[model samples]
Target: MNTKKKSTSRIMLDYLFRFKFYIFLAVLASIPVSIISASPAYIVQKLLDKVLIAGNNNYLLIIVVGLPILFLLKGIFYFIQNYLMAYVGQKLIISIRYDVFSHLQKVSLSFFSKKTTGQLISRMTNDVNMVQAMVKGSMTILNDIISLICLFGYIFYLHWKLTLLVFVVLPFIGGIVRKFSKKIRRVGHDMQEKMADVTSVMHEAISGVQITRAFTMEEHEIERFHNKDRESMKAQLRGVRVQSTVLPVVEFMNTMGLAIVMFYGGQIVINGELTTGQLIGFLAGLGMTFSPIKRLTNINSVIQQSLAAADRIFSLMDEDIEEGEEDKNIEIDDLKGSVEFEDVFFSYDDKYDVIRGLDLKVRPGEIVAFVGPSGGGKSTIVSLIPRFYTPYKGEIRVDGKNINDINIKSLRKHMAIVPQDTILFTGTIKENISYGNPEATDEEIIEAAKMANAHNFISDFRKGYETQVGERGAMLSGGQKQRIAIARALLRNAKILILDEATSALDSESEALVQDALENLMEEKTTFVIAHRLSTIRKADKICVIDDGRIVQLGTHDQLMEKGGEYRQIYNAQFYFLDEASGE
Candidate 1:
């Protein structure tokens, strides 16, 4: 691996520099516009010197016809310059955005755990947009610089002394621009942060609208959004205040320089030291020159703002992706579905272990149930089997082969997990059912839906299998979403299955339907069921009572009840009402 570090400017330029042909064309197109821009002054010089002073009809006619023709050419070149430069800027933004999004997809889940979705969204959208603006501004600055040089070349030829005087305020303009650039950059960063806060608040409020309305917190949420919006406004105002101040100061200095040049040049014209035409042409060129200088100074602030955004974007890109298990070359095609966790220790954060020295084993086609209090690592244990996370110590094996030795994709291909919160994408019912098996035929999708007890309700919809499930399945009820999720997993036809409280959130009728579907789905698969309701797992081949990240008791339902341990206590606590109703 090369250890050489690249500068931020170099990294950003690499993207822009890729389209050298487009940039070259833009620059070449700008040249004619720059020359044409300076031509009017020279044309007026001829009109005044040769026509008015010499009483020449030829010079007058040329001036009348030439001015419009020159402007027309300028317009054509200007259009080409603008179009090509904008094309390059937009292309650069597209490439950068693609890189950022692709990198995000490859980064480990831990990276996401450490950062909010809103922050990531802000980086991909707002930061890239700022960079886009800077790229366009850069092209404008380049064009202005070229135009300034051409204008100066003309003015110096007419009067070198007066041209020197016109640049008197250049040092002062530079100082003011440097000072203001810092303020603009500082405020730009603050504004971006405030906008990110607003994004986060919006995401939270939108995602939790149900809870907010249920708890009568609509007004509170409105106030929360308002506070974030106000902060963003304040930051924008500060940036505006800084930007607004710089332009006036720059204009004042340019005006001062223009005044000195006019006062000095007038004396020369009066003393017959210079011609009236020469003075007029020199003044015109000087004015054109200073306009670009002022804009370039302002452009410095824009560049600073873009650099701040680039810093944020590049920092995100530099994050280390999760690395483990990829080096393992073993491939598992026909897994026997026997899974074992041998003294596993794992944690989301290194500070505390959520799964500590835990061990478990399940044979092929066996149904094992995990019963634990909330946060007892039940879900984490199941997540490990699919390589969503890796244990800090010890090893997990499937069919006597270390899981880390198996290709992650191949390992996961043999397993399917139906989480408590069923996440369905915004697509047709057929798409959702075949999510796990994209190659599934229409007939197979229907079969999977039927197996999950979802066919009847789906067929009742106007569009049937093609009916759209709104974002995250918002168009469907909780029971319907869970049923679709089961249908998705069933379509996979994996050797190993995990059911994490699949029926916990459902009503009695939904639970009955889902439970029946689950029974069919788990018929020949090695199943791990994490259940909060003890009654649901009473007939499991093995019930493991987990406490404080360890399996404290392992036995069948009748054996655990007879043993009278933690399992019995949990079973009694959950079913005590049923016993009371039956007068037990």
Candidate 2:
């Protein structure tokens, strides 16, 4: 989906409209609260004129009885208004979170490569929280606005001439709000960025705690986290300074307007142009009006901060998640193991081609190994077969049909990968094995684990298959994790397999057993391997030597050895020490 560069208001409005029915109820609830709020000034005018000055005891009992009933109704409606808006705010927040997370899953891997786990986590929890406050704040503003309208109506009824003068102070208040708004917004945005940095720093330190202890870098890690936290604190303090100044400036403007009303309204009463009760009621209503007007001034700060948060959140929501994501209309129920790359030109950054006009073909049930120097694009070649990345030019065909024309999920369904660094989710051994095929029976899971040589270690534990792997399989050793990964792939029963140093972590005995198991598993499958150990791929039908993004040699291992090139050079580099020790 293309990113939408929507305005702040539009972004908020679009979501609010989704729950407009509830929002309407909340605003409707506020109307009664607003109406009851005007009752105080009217009651004051009546008590002064009828009960005190006119000495009318007949209306005294009615005023006393009516006052309590009016307040009781106000209390009930106020509760309704507050509860409804809070409910709406919470629902809107959940919707925002749902969409953001769902979108993250659909985006390409490149999007995740550029983002840190902490920044994404912070955006999900912290930034979304900030938007939640904005949502509630807007509803509060709306309630205050309705109150202002009611109070001003009563004030104008009491006396229009003086009411016009009160409005003169409005333009000044608005000017002061405008003056501070930009500053507050800038500070708020800076504060959010600093906080995200703090979260990222903490995440890295926590996740890499073992690395820190191994190198005795605990003090350094602690100091790094402290510095990042302090930076966030300073940004928060700057925002507080900006917001704190806004209130007093707005307060000063309100006090000035009230003084004008008091002096002029007092003169009008003395001159017999207005009744004393009417003048007092006008002041009462005007005082009520100023409270909301003052809140309206502070709203500039709330609104600016909200806009800043919305800008950050909406930007992520608007990011273009590249085309050809999972779940396309095209599905492949049957797949031949054959894959061919035709004149592919690729780049991680478009500046230089990583694979310059490369071409390769793999027959069904063949083992193809890629051997090269580090950063020679060996891994990149295997990565392209899964469509993890698309070639800038040319086509990758699976079963002789362009992969771009197939459903990504369906394309991936027939393939399984065992990455160089094994990642096992926090779960039991049985659960991780069944992750490949969730509907697999317990017997099938045990069978796959046995094939990968993981069943023995798993059965040795007191909990057996139920033993926890901890976060990222921290409780398990490297070899154990790798075996489990292999078991998962074996259970998947894919026609196409990718093994990136799948046995690198295993001891010699385990490696021998796992290699045999893999050979049996790879019997009728097309497999791609990025081999660091030259001896591992000796039996591969085709060995390709990749150098600086192009295949420099391609033959059987023995053929490549006899041909004498990059493959032989890499093989010699690995066995050079052993060759010297043996005096070969």
Candidate 3:
């Protein structure tokens, strides 16, 4: 589904229309509240004219009883209005947040690479929250307008001439609002950007805390955060400055208009052209009208801020996700895993190709290993197998079927990946192991753990399978975490396995245990191993030595060693030269 970019107004209007029923009820609730709000002025006018001046005790009963009834009804309707608006605001926020997060899952990995975690987090949290406030402000402005209209109707009934004069100064106030609106929006955008920066800095500091402490650079991180904090503070202050000028200017205009009305209306009363009750009632209605008007004016700044936030949120919602192949809906469950890459050309940046015209084939159940220097596109090849990225100009196939024709979810279901960096959620060991195959029985989970060589150590703990591994499995040692990850993959029992430099960072003892688990896991599945250590892939069925984004040597390790090519050079560099240097 292609989502065209939406304007801020259109996006807001979409949500408004989606929940129109609630909005309608809320608007309906505001009508009575607005009518009752104007009642106070009318009641006061009646009390003055009939009770005080006329000395009519008959008006006292209405004042004492009718006013309370109106007040009670006003309170009830106001609660309805407030509750419905809040309900709409909260509903919109939750729906949008869900869409944003779900949309992110459907997008390609390229999107994540381009966006920082903190920036995305801010979009979900800060941006969504800002939109919530915007919704409330919009509802407030609507209700205020309704209230203002009701008050205006009463005032005009009392004195149409004075009502016209009150409207005279409104143009000037609106002009002032228009003049400051762009500047306020600019400041608000800056403030949001600076806050995102602060969030990014905090994320980096927290994630890299170990590195910072190891290098004794805590003060450096603190100073960096301080700079971002100060920038955010300055941006907020600028927004505040622009917003502060708006209300005062609006209030001053209102005061001047009120003074003119008071003087002219008082003169009319003295000339016996108007009754004191009418004059006071008009003034009371005028005061009520301007209160909402003032609130409406202040809401302008909040509206601008929300529009800025809305723009960002809509932009994110419009980002292009990885689309499925056009009209191709082939479903695959159990794959034969006869993988092949034909004339594949790929590039992270178009200028520099990462996988250049690469070609390879692995027979079903073959154990193929890719060995290469750091930048030689080894990881890129395995990543392409699952369509994490698409080739610039080539085709990838599994069992003679073009990968692009396969449903992405169905294709991925047959493959399991244990990456170099193992990530585990905060959960019990049993939960982590059963992450991939959630329906696995306890016996099956323990069997998979045993196959991964994780069962012994796991049982050593008092809680066994129920032991909690803290955030990202922080409570577990590196080898323990890696084994758990492998156990998860083992439980998946996928037809194709991708081991990406799995044992590169482990100690010798841990590497041996992980290698034993790997040997067992690779028994019958077609495996693609990305080997960093030269010793690991010696027994692989086929070894492809990659360099400069192309395979330069292809053979078994023994064949490559005998061929005296790039493969032999790498092997000697790691085995012979490294051993000799250590001896020295």
Q: Pick the candidate with the highest TM-score.
A: 3
lDDT (C-alpha, whole model) for all candidates? 0.85, 0.83, 0.87
Q: By TM-score, rank the candidates, best first.
A: 3, 1, 2
**Model 1 lowest lDDT segment of ten:** 1-10
- What is the total number of backbone clashes in candidate 3? 0
Error of 3 at 352 (Å): 1.5
- What is the per-residue lDDT of model 3 for residues 1-584, given as tens digits with 9 covering 90 to 100? 22365568877888778899999998998888878876778887888889888988888987898888888998999999999999999999998888888888888888889888888888888978988998899878877887788888888888888789998998999899999988887887788888888888999899889899999999999999999999999999999999998888899999999999999999989998778988888888888877887788788899898888877877787877777655669988668889999999999877999999999999988888898788899999999999999998989999899988898888888999989899899899999999979999999999999999999999999999999999889899999998999999999999999988664477878887887887778889999999764445765899999998899999997898899978888877766664465463
Candidate 3: residue 121 lDDT (0-100): 84
TM-score of each: 0.93, 0.93, 0.95
- Give the per-residue lDDT digits (tens) of candidate 1, residues 221-288: 99999999999999989888888898988888888988998999999899997899889888887777
RMSD of each: 2.6, 2.7, 2.3
351-446, model 2: which lDDT tens digit per residue?
Answer: 988898788999998899888888889888888887888888999999998888888888999999988988899989889999999999999999
Candidate 1 Cα errors over 4 Å, as ranges: 1-5, 324-326, 503-505, 533-536, 578-584
